[model samples]
Target chain A: MQFWPWYLGGVALTTVAVGHWLLMNRMMAVSGRVTALVNRVRFGPDKAPALSGKELEDALLAATLAAFGDEALKAPPTAPEPAPEPAPSARPQLTLTKPQGPGMHALFFFGLAIGGLLSVLLAGGLEVSPSLRGARFEALFDGPGRYAVLLLGGLCVGFGTRMTGGCTSGHGLCGVSRFQPASLLATAAFFGTGIVTSFAVALLLA
Target chain B: MADPPCPHMKSCEMYEIFTFSETLAVWKTRYCQSDYSRCERYQRALKGQPVPVNLLPNGHLLEK
Candidate 1:
């Protein structure tokens, strides 16, 4: 099969993980990032204000004042006068007390989808197919049954990742690279589980 | 205590002004992705309305 070499793929993944840490000062873990985004979305506008909007602004203002002295807060003499305030009733009202929904993680998740598409294009198009008795398996779990299994699997994966506090990308890639003991343990569990599951499935089929 | 000016209002502590349900609602919307589709913030963005900073999680400011 035509495929990217494992070494090259490893190098690319390492670069991405390192870049994520350098640029964002964050672990490149998709699950955690998604979880954070989910949390922000579930919380309503009332909680939004506390998520670093005004605090960020205040911090910046304080930094500027400290760096340049009180003069930084003063308007430049050449600056134009602020526009007259509109009547309160005439202004557009915002429900600032409500949750704002997904934040920047929206872009991250969206970018992940885009990246998948880009990879397919770069790889000269991907030919997807099921593995190991595909037709027989489809016949047995056709239609809604197949969907049910897929959904169940997804939920299991999500639950497992949350309970473990990391996923493959978080533990196997970022965590292992960092030499974290927890990540090493988790990665070992992942590999062991995969091996056991494969053998179990093979036995079942036999 | 009187509420601070909107510009000066910072920190999650400001949420105290809201009713318990209101605060809970915001919290649920932020942490629960399942309710995202029905969220007012998401709906407004869909309509091209400007969303304030508190609604967006801290991360790369795609547009600044």
Candidate 2:
């Protein structure tokens, strides 16, 4: 879309997803591999693997760029955090708590539900503009069975997020920015599976 | 070749003055909880592991 807002919003989101991976020294694997990293960091090296500087940069860039919004691109030095405590013992590290079992997970699902509810309510409303067409309060139900689909979409999104350990918002958006190899693979796998499932469902529903 | 630990890792006072605090943060937070997960150094060095299923080049793309 030529819409600047959508493009900008996407960038903002990506930064958030990938930033932690970059920081954590792990590849941004959306394939539920982050748990491995987290275990190592919290428990011991026996649990997870570590990352390299390049990998770190990739992850942070991915998440920070996507989630940091326009502000980060311009003002990165503002928030100088204190140095973190060193690990009690040395081990390869991966995974971060932000993208996993946290409020971020629930927020993603909430956004999906709201999007679906909006779509259903405005199914047949009206179109104001190309970019703003979906923004109208009444046009939520403009499409055929959009409400039902959105509700279903919400469930699908939630399930996918849980299964993948993160959603597009989690892995695709944030995971990639950090240059997480895992995130890259996970995102690819998600897309690949999504495409196959889409075709299957298309034929079934057709 | 065996090298001494990065002098930064030896004592708390020496660690603080090191130029690689940012570098250290990446590895340290990877294995931490609650707040610090941005440290890639900690994750890979202290808390990481190999992927169970190889998803890299040889695994899917260049496989025989």
Candidate 3:
């Protein structure tokens, strides 16, 4: 199986990142997008009230009247008494438009997963044999123990990503490409932590 | 009756009239559960095609 050159992959990523900015007017930060979605769900509808039924009806009536122009306004009242205008509180509350939604972020992650699956299939299926041979930590822990360690690592990664406001793709790929100072600092911290952890693990296992 | 100003109006001077949370609330629901696949831009993305700048609601991807 043949793999595409690393530079080609980089070029593709760069194109997508730039396209995201130009087309969506948004920075391509997968973690931040996902976090925003999560926050919306975690915070209920009360956090941001939708237009009340009366407000919606009032808005529709106003739009209809605007569309009819002077003819609607000039029409003589059929009844002896004219209808009163709705209260100010019943008016629709205007709000800012969002650029993108959670669904896009969900689809983006789905694409990432599909891309990985395609790469593995193209590489001629998954290898069944044990690939981690003679690793110091593998000898120290049994299968179940190794899984526990993995679960813990996974939790740490999820928590860390949330706390740091990004992951490798968000900070390293998109952020660094844009030359953000905070991203540079975060990326450096990520590498520094990984190096320190690896040495710590080796010492403990030995 | 005068039409209500759209919350998304680019002018920042209107900030005093509307609170930050009110603005954020509108954005939160704009694309929260929207179907991106229905968007022409998203379809272009799926086919590995170029996206146009004037595509509908580039962020929400929903035609208002």
Candidate 4:
């Protein structure tokens, strides 16, 4: 079994996490991309915004001024440190529009599949095997039941991803690298659960 | 009566970033303070969407 070394996998993961942000200025969330694809299918195309880039910036500036007055820009220095609690009354009814389309994420999701295929092709010739390719999985889920178990496991992963709003790539790689508290907690939970589950499975199989 | 800050302000990366940059004050003033409902991060958080750390108040990603 030819497996890529851990360091190489780490490097690739870092590049994907950091390069995505460097190039696109957005967090690389594989689950988010999947969600976006699902949303694109469910909701059809998002209402494309009329403005972007400089136009959007200018519009935001204008809206900010209207909402908070001319002093809004300069009032920062005078504003209390640690941010005062906001008064709830009389907020301006304004919403800034943004261009959000799932097209890029859809491509990203497909790109992941292609990347995996390419990696497999480059490492070793692809084999079309109907068997579950792991000894543990074989022991535990030999037969057509394996596919059903795999489906259930995938569903659980998807559900958990949606519930947490992130997954290993998003929270584990990007969030942990950035030292986000939420990410740290999430990653800890992920690893903890994974360890316990694996142990439980091993004991059950034994 | 002072209402609470944006529910996510404590954990929001934008709030942390805005704390240092004088030019970005309008973000804190306009959204983080009272009109947080208008904030894209706030809206996304409300919808149970994954709010990226660099997602700005106006829903654009913070560019380098």
lDDT of 2 by residue, A80-136 (tens): 765465774643343221223334434545655675456445555333432323333
Predicted complex 1: CAPRI docking category: incorrect
- Report how closely model 3 matches the true complex, as a DockQ value: 0.04
Q: In candidate 4, which residue ranges exceed 4 Å CA deviation?
A: A48-58, A65-100, A128-136, B1-44, B49-64
Ranking by DockQ, best first? Answer: 4, 1, 2, 3
Model 4, B1-64: lDDT tens digits are: 7656797886675586556434457778768987898899899877865565446787765332
Taking all chains together, the TM-score of candidate 1 against the true structure is: 0.52
- Please give the lDDT score at residue A163 for candidate 1: 75
By TM-score: ranked, best first: 4, 1, 3, 2
Candidate 2: regions farther than 4 A off: A1-6, A14-145, A195-206, B1-64
**Strongest candidate by DockQ:** 4
Candidate maximizing lDDT:
4
Off by over 4 Å in 1: A45-102, A126-140, B1-64
Minimal lDDT window, size 10, model 1 chain A: A44-53
- Residues A61-172, model 4: lDDT tens digits: 5555655676756766556654544454632222223434666766787889899888878878666554557687786666688878878888998888888878999889
Candidate 1 vs 3: which has more lDDT: 1
- For candidate 3, the TM-score is 0.51
State the fnat of model 4: 0.12
What is the C-alpha lDDT profile of model 1 across B1-64, one tens digit per residue? 5222222122222233221222122322232323345444445445534444444222212111
- Worst 10-residue lDDT window for candidate 2 chain A reads A91-100
User: Evaluated with TM-score, which candidate comes out highest?
Assistant: 4
- Candidate 4: residue pairs that collide: none
